[model samples]
Target: MFKILIIEDDLKMREIILENIHRWGFDGLYVKDFNQVFNEFINYEPHLILLDINLPSYDGFYWCGKIREVSKVPIIFISSRNSNMDIVMAINMGGDDFVQKPFSLEVLMAKINALLRRTYDYMSTEANVIEHRNLILNLKDSTVSYNDKKVELTKNEFKILYVLMKDKGSIISRDSIMRSLWEDENFVDDNTLTVNINRLRKKLEDLDIENYIQTKKGQGYIII
Candidate 1:
């Protein structure tokens, strides 16, 4: 089953969208905090995103751009704004489709299924695999299974791992980590990154991951 991520701030709309996801026969995620869009997006690893434009601090376009920076998962803009410019802007910012607000729940679910089918249905039955030592990261399925046992990772942990794995054996600076993981937040300090990294390290350790994600004395971390 395909997973959906809803980024809308409206409580009723979000619940409706989530409740109707089962109606579309799809399993997915609904975000808890507008401020933590990136966090939820990375952690859930949903195949598609349902985003709203008028958000709490930053708008949908901004969050869409942020998501595009790391992942190519599909994004659909769902908002009250029906202006041509808004629609055009949404597409330009990397949204796959636009669903104007006050939409029918049935139609919304249909659009979601259509998009998922088009993007993933016939593409490949295989999951994307990236490895370092014994650890395996499946990009397509957004899963990091260890030694054939699925090791669960939060969005932050996965994103951090993705960035690190992409630059394996290289020193990825703390600033860089902050930039990638903290893009969606209004303000993220070093403490937040530290906490996230620490938690990720614990998870990796539990998986018996083999790597040297070394903290280079105020420089950064390197998965060597």
Candidate 2:
């Protein structure tokens, strides 16, 4: 199943698009936090993206450029704005196509199918991988590896590592980590996050990476 990432901020519209996508036999993932769009995108490694123009903090055009920096994954801009300038800017910012709002689910599916065919047919399925200090985090496979050693990680472990390494030098607060893990505000206790971090740390230790994840007293965690 091809994975499609939806970046629309409107909850109702996002749900509508996701429901249609599932009915059409495609996997759909929605962005939970607008501020972490790029990080979520990298973690999901979707085959295509459905982005909107109006968003919180930063607009879709900004995110389109950010996604372009890392991957050539197909991006289709979906927004209510249909002005010529908006259309032209979308294309210039590395968007594969643009679909105005009030679009039919049928048409959206057709566009998605065409893009997937054109992009993936005979194209290399390159693993979505990120590296920091010689430790490779393969997002596609949910594994981490170092020289002559490899370790598989659970979903939580992979997500925690992704956030830490993606930022690398900066300290990520505990609240931020929990939000990344459970965006719905579900009750994931403080101990849960600590346990997950400890487990992840041990895995790194197994790969001969000692103190790879450091704790910032009274702040949070950092990987430098």
Give each model's whole-structure lDDT.
0.79, 0.89
TM-score of each: 0.55, 0.55
Regions of candidate 1 where Cα sits further than 4 Å from its true position: 126-224
Q: Highest lDDT: which candidate?
A: 2
Model 2 quality (TM-score): 0.55
Q: Mind giving the per-residue lDDT tens digits that candidate 1 earns over 1-224?
A: 57889888888888888888855446868878788999998888899999999999889999999999999999989999999999999999999999887888757766765677678843266347778776788776566767766776777677788878878888877766765554322445789889989988887777777444778887789887
Deviation (Å) of 149 in candidate 2: 48
Model 1: lDDT equals 0.79
The lDDT of model 2 is 0.89
Pairs of colliding residues, candidate 1:
42-155, 43-155
